[model samples]
Target chain A: MSKQELTILGRAADDACCQGLASAPLDEQRAADLAKIFKALGDPVRLRLMSMIASREGGEVCVCELTPAFDLSQPTISHHLKLLRQAGLIDCERRGTWVYYWVLPGVLDRLAGFLAVPHSAKEPV
Target chain B: MSKQELTILGRAADDACCQGLASAPLDEQRAADLAKIFKALGDPVRLRLMSMIASREGGEVCVCELTPAFDLSQPTISHHLKLLRQAGLIDCERRGTWVYYWVLPGVLDRLAGFLAVPHSAKEPV
Candidate 1:
């Protein structure tokens, strides 16, 4: 599901070019698509989970390892992970008794590219 | 109010270095602060408003000019703009009948820098 979403998101990102948000006004459809991804990251718990997964060494982390870091319940953490996956920011696999998650390659940079302001659009310092 | 929030956000961004989210796990406070900004952009209406302001020439747009672009009422558009301002993404000033808005100098770039996964973190293509 996320892989499919990522493809759609990739096309949206491509349509806007490098400085997506700042280069031109966004049309409603593209804005709606991007907004869903941003909304997924809007929660503090999800943001923390994203950072944890994104910064993990060796590129992925087990669900067993992730749950211990937060005071929230396992289900709660899993819920956050689900939202991240739905946003196309991360993907996971069930391995034995646990799920392992990794940041989807290039998604973060694509999001960064989308949000970045071009030099010409920047205000004079 | 937005200026004060911008200063605080700047400090948070500086503390994390260039590869903020990908370099290390974010602490609770920083995650909360960054989440608010992302949340502000999470709505399609607000996202559209942000792009319209950020992409405008001369780096600013009048409330009058912004209103006609959407199907929303002026007050509804103003509410979304208020959320953007509260997130420290934009600032505005009233001039007679209209308020003019511009993206806060480097906030978009700062946000992009925070979300960008460093080259080292990228998976081999």
Candidate 2:
């Protein structure tokens, strides 16, 4: 995404103001932005990779540590990780021989908050 | 999905207890289930369609009303709606000649809540 696009997402997270999809539809740009993230998460392997990274100790994990946990090759795991990074769901930095990854704070929160039903809609119908 | 698969999704949502993908790697069954939902949300047209249905006035919108909002053909819109229904994110009822769509309720909530970061990981690093 461009800086401007990132800013829109930043604003949504900072304000915590995105309404539930049930309450109102997303604007075109927002829907497009969100769909990309959801698309990145659509794969079983990628989703598992994200979970491992997000829930890891200290909220981050190294590529080396993540590789052995799966039946897939290191390159395959790295490919999944690369997709997550491109979606802005996670970020990584090289630390000596291994690259460590962590969830980019608030992206998931924005999504979770976006889907949250308003108080009026929370009760059973 | 088969009744067995529906049972699994029902179990996950009813329990309100899917661990966030970032928390731990998703087991094969859970990953496959969630990936289908995420994949349904992956498309730009489908995402907008879902948001429109989810956030529509009176909690529903008819196929007639929805088609005009897009540049696509009615069949195209219907195809997207079908995908949403197949994903279990929304359902519809036919009243007269038109079919009205609405979010299924809790399905988005389950997906949203599933992405939520645990309290332990909430603080900024």
Judging by lDDT against the true structure, name the best candidate.
1
lDDT of 1 at B123: 48
Whole-model alpha-carbon lDDT for candidate 2: 0.73
Provide the fnat value for model 1, as a fraction from 0 to 1.
Answer: 0.81
Write out the backbone clash pairs for model 1. none
Per-residue CA lDDT of model 2 for B51-124, tens digit only, reads 78777767788888888888899889988888777777777888888778877767877777788865665655
Instruction: Looking at model 2, give its docking quality level.
Output: medium
| DockQ of the two-chain complex in candidate 1 | 0.80
- Deviating ranges (above 4 Å) for candidate 1: A1-4, A17-19, A118-125, B1-4, B14-19, B120-125
Pairs with backbone N, CA or C atoms under 3 Å apart (clashes), candidate 2: A22-B54, A51-B21, A51-B22, A55-B22
lDDT of 1 by residue, A8-109 (tens): 765665665464897889899999888888998898889988999888988889989889998999999988888888777789888788778999877777
In terms of lDDT, the poorest run of 10 residues in model 2 chain A is: A1-10
Mind sharing the TM-score for model 1?
0.89
Choose the strongest candidate by TM-score: 1
